[model samples]
Target: MIISILVLEGPYNHEASDSAYNFIQAALAKGHAIRGIFFYDDGVYNVTRLMDPPQDDRHISRRWSELGATGIDMVVCIAAAKRRGITNEVLAPNIRISGLGQLASMIHESDRIVTFGD
Candidate 1:
């Protein structure tokens, strides 16, 4: 199955981000293909490379980068990113900034669209 994920919350503020991450990982492990991950609202924070969590904590942004390394497209809504002060200079290497049109395209192309949080 081809899956696309939309995340609506920030990384540490809620479990939604972690849940989405685990879901993607498990889905990939099961040989499912991920169409993409589109970040909106507070979820745009996931693409920021400036996140420096506690040493023992999981670096969510890094995990996203790693996932992108495996060829899964990762996108952050441009409006959302700008509203949250996430700029291209601070964006993760594999994360791209785009408009809602890209999200629409992902939804149209995927077999399933899974949304996390509000």
Candidate 2:
């Protein structure tokens, strides 16, 4: 299956991001293809390269960047990101800032769209 993910929440403060990551990992392990991951609202923070957590804590941004490095399309909504003060200079590697049209295209091309958030 070709799956696209929509995340609306941020990391650490909520479980939505973790859940979404686990789901994607599981899907990939099962030989499923991820068409894209669109980060909206607070979810846009997940791809910030400036994120620095405690040494004992999992680096959420790094995790997303590594996943993105696997060739899966990772996008942060440009409008949402800008509203939250996120810019291209702060984006993690392999992640891109794009408009909502990318999300629409993901939905159109994907066989399934799984959303994680309120």
Listed in order, each prediction's TM-score against the native is: 0.97, 0.98
Where's the lowest-lDDT run of ten residues in candidate 1? 44-53
Clashes within 3 Å, all models in order: 0, 0
Reference-based lDDT, residue 29, model 2: 95
lDDT of 1 at 87: 89
Could you list the CA RMSD of all candidates, in the order they appear?
Answer: 0.8, 0.6
lDDT of 1 at 23: 97
Clashing pairs in 1: none
Q: Estimate, for each residue in 1-115, the C-alpha lDDT of model 2 and write its tens digit.
A: 9999999999899999999999999999999999999999999989899999999999999999999999999999999999999999999999999999999999999999999
Off by over 4 Å in 2: none
Top TM-score hit: 2
Q: By TM-score, how accurate is candidate 2?
A: 0.98
